[model samples]
Target chain A: MSERLEEICSIELPTGESVGVHRRRFTGGLGPHVAIVAGIRGDTPEGTRVAHAVARHLSTHHERLCGTVDVYPCVNPLAAHHGARHWPGFDLDLNRRFPGRADGHAPDRVARTLLDATRAADMVIELRGAHPAFREETQAHVRHDQPVALERALRANVRVVWRRSAELQGTGTLAAELPGLICLEGGVGNRLTDGVGLELCDGVLNLLVVAGVLPEDALPFHWAAIQRPLVATDEDIVRVRATRGGLFLPSGRMWGEVEVGTPLGEVVDPIAGETLEMITAPVAGRVLAMREQPVVYPGSLVARLVAT
Target chain B: MSVVFRLEAPYRGEYALHRLTFGGNGPAAVAMVAGLHGNEVNGIQALNLVAGMLRVMRPKRPVHLLPCVNSIGADEARKRWPFDDRDINAAFPGDPEGAPVERIAAAVMDATDAELCIDVHSGATTVREHPHARVPLSGPELEHARAMMLPVVWRRRGDRYEGGLVGAWRGAGREALQVRGGRGLALDMDDATTLARGLVRLLAHLGLISHQDTGTPSHDTDHVQDYRSMAGGFFVPEVQTGERVVSGKLLGLVRNPLGGEPIEEIRAHKAGMVLAVRVYPMVHAQELVVRIAEDAT
Candidate 1:
């Protein structure tokens, strides 16, 4: 076991200031190299925290590992510096600048450098947090056609393993770049939640063990302690939105099962304090996400559900 | 006034685009367009103000005024197309049979076919901007920009004109200029009036309109510099827009919102006019704090 951190790249801003991107490598013997990346968007601090946690555990037990494990805790350090969602001066979403140019601006150079560093890995895993306005249940997302990713995501100790079509996913995202990549996300954005970081850390470690990069006995917890997730498809997931603009008060809890037409929340006028409407679940399912922020627009998504 | 184009909306009624033409017409002259992004109401206000002036006066050459292009977005106070959230300015020289915003861009481009064009805009939501003209350094466009007699005529580099409406106009063989003022989603009456007067001055310089008091054109420096923040925090700015500054001057200070510890100090790099300043100061690291236009020696 060695304690070594490699500085992969450094991006120099227009003002002659720079930020370093560091990657930790755990190598035992030779097999397929697996890369774990997180915190592409600075608002998702949970991903960075989980990546560091997994790296810390892997460093202690690196001697028993088989394949190499590379962990990039935070890719966009400048954005992370201020807890912002986009690159600072550019006001650009870094994830959207994939396959970037080396000779371009600072953000482009950083994207190009990160892409180059991870291109050679046999498997890639991206960790993210829920949007800033909502809290999500721990889940793993895999492309429906990627059988390998679907099989690997089952061991991530998440509550729901969603296999969705690639077209449904947004363009220029990390998952869009790597077709079969597993994306694990939970918790709230910009702020850390209780127990979410540890849960995601354990999931990544379990994934590393399942990939034969880390030995089973090296895991901090027993294999039986892992949660068996309910595997689902795109059709089994439903998004519930509010029709009125107001404060959305969610009555449901994350990952809690409910019957059809169950009362999920109420939208009330923030000033008048009058209940405008009551939002209800359309089908019997488990609440996958609910709005944490009170204020909402008319088309704002209030909850996500995993149907039975 | 002519109805150049019309588009149908899903729930709302149809939108009609108006183009006002002046003069029996000599050689086709400048085409003035504004309100490409609907939330930039100052541009629309300035164009309309120019339109009112054009009604009383006659020009020696032809001038086309496209006052408001994205009326739907303007109605909702949105910067982009309300339907698809697409920026009309980005889809320039657009397809006639494309999406709603693209079709609007194509129609606007077709309507404003002239020798020279000027696209007017306001600043983004948070910042207030002085009436200024932006053009590439050392060109005919820069000369036209200087003739406007606006407060700040910024001769910027070609690289800064990437993928915008003005860029697309230049790409299509028309000498294009970009004029900016006020702020988005709201109208600054004085800035809009100043910009309107500047447009009249540019038209008179092109022999399109004859009006006195175009004023003695100030030959300002073409060199411009940007000032950026050093750290991430709530920035408290000490300077206002269009204020003159010397070297080592304090532009703003980044302080911790909770405990009020000074995180960083933003200072002017050179002696110049503060053309732009950060108004809403919840800033991230390396964000732009001030942009200065250095006076030519």
Candidate 2:
């Protein structure tokens, strides 16, 4: 186990000032290698923290592990320096430059390097945090056609496992490149929340156990404690948007259950303090995400509800 | 109106790049393109206004007007292609076999091959820009830019030209320049009129159009300076774009949004014409708030 664990790849930055990409490898006998990546975007600190939590548990139970687990805690270091969403100076989004050119600038070169490194892994798992404007519930996203990924996400301790169409995903992203990849995201953006990180950390560990990378007994928490996630499709998730542009004051909490016509939030005129519109739940479901940022545009998403 | 280029768009009809040509067309020269970004409607209006004037007058050489290149994005009021959010400007000298936006870029590049190319644009949605010409210091292009009779002729370092449409045109061995005015998403009739007049003056300078005294060429100093915010806060500008400022003048103030207390006072370091001003209040640390082009002595 110790011999196999020494094969992690770590690439230094071009500035010769930093380590850009760090990979931690854990291997037992070796059957199928799986990779877990987080913090492609600097604003997604929750994923980085969760990656570290999983790494800590894996280090203690290295002997019982099978195959290999490659963990990349932070991919975009320069952007992470100031907790920016995009790479500074270039102002490029690293995720949107995948399959990037080697001869290109700093961001493009980093994207190319990361893509080349992860291409050979048997299974790829990308971890991310919610958008900075909203607080999201724990969820696992898999491509609709990837039944194998769907099965794996079911065992990942999340409340709802969503199978989304590839068309709904953005181009040049990691998931777009790897169709079968399972993407796990939760918690708030830029900041880490208690219990959310630990739960997602456990979910990744449980998936590792299910993939035969780690033994069932090696897990710190009992398998019964993991939530049996409900499977949902893209159509089952409903987005609630504010009809008017104003200060949105949310009443519904994250992951709170609600029925149709329930008051979710209100858009009040900032200057006059008059209620412009009342945002209500459109379907009987649980709140997937709620806008944390008060200021919003006319079509700005205020909340998302997942139908049971 | 002639169809200069045609591009196929997904989930929508084909996009046509129309050209309004004027005069008897002796030596073909000077092509102007605007609205590559759909939200930049000021340039589109300016080009259309120029086209309307050119239709009545006859000139020696040909002038091609590409009023709106990103027609589909203009329909949705988006800066980039809505099908896949892509900036057509970034896809310069583009690929024919690429995506929808890239194909459009390629078509425009192929269609607008002329002696001189002017890529017209409005400022970003968050900022308002004065009518100005951006050119390199000490060159024939700089002299040509000066003849435009715009409010500001900013002679910048050539190294600043990279990855943009003008840069790509220069790389392809064509003389290219950029003219900017007004703000994005909104049309300023006065700014658009100024830009249209500047284009006419540029055409007259090129011997393509005949005009009686297109204002004495502002033999302005080629010097320009940028004003950047020192801290992240809500920026409140005291001066508007195109306003002449003296040294030691208050350009704007950066105030903390939470407490409404002034964090930093941005003062003009040099006496110049305010070429640009940040319209959006919320600013990040070190972002460009104003750009001042020093007036000729």
Candidate 2 on B1-297: residue-level lDDT in tens? 899766433224346788877767555587889999999999999999889878876667787888898887899998876544578898888866554566677878877777899999999888899988888777777878888888778777888777668988888888889999999999988889999998888888888777754564552656777787766678899999878899999999988777778989999888988888988887765567898888666
Predicted candidate 1 versus true structure: per-residue lDDT over B201-249, tens digit per residue: 8888877777886465643667777665555567788898778889899
Error (Å) of candidate 1 at residue A79 is: 1.2
Where does candidate 1 chain A have its weakest 10-residue lDDT segment? A10-19
Q: Give candidate 1's total backbone clashes.
A: 0
Q: List ranges where model 1 is wrong by over 4 Å.
A: B1-297
Candidate 2 chain B minimal-lDDT segment of 10 residues: B6-15
Question: Which one wins on DockQ?
Answer: 1
TM-score for model 2? 0.58
Question: Which prediction has the highest lDDT against the true structure?
Answer: 1
For residue B223, model 1's alpha carbon misses the true position, in angstroms, by: 23
Which residue runs does candidate 2 get wrong by more than 4 Å? A3-19, B1-297
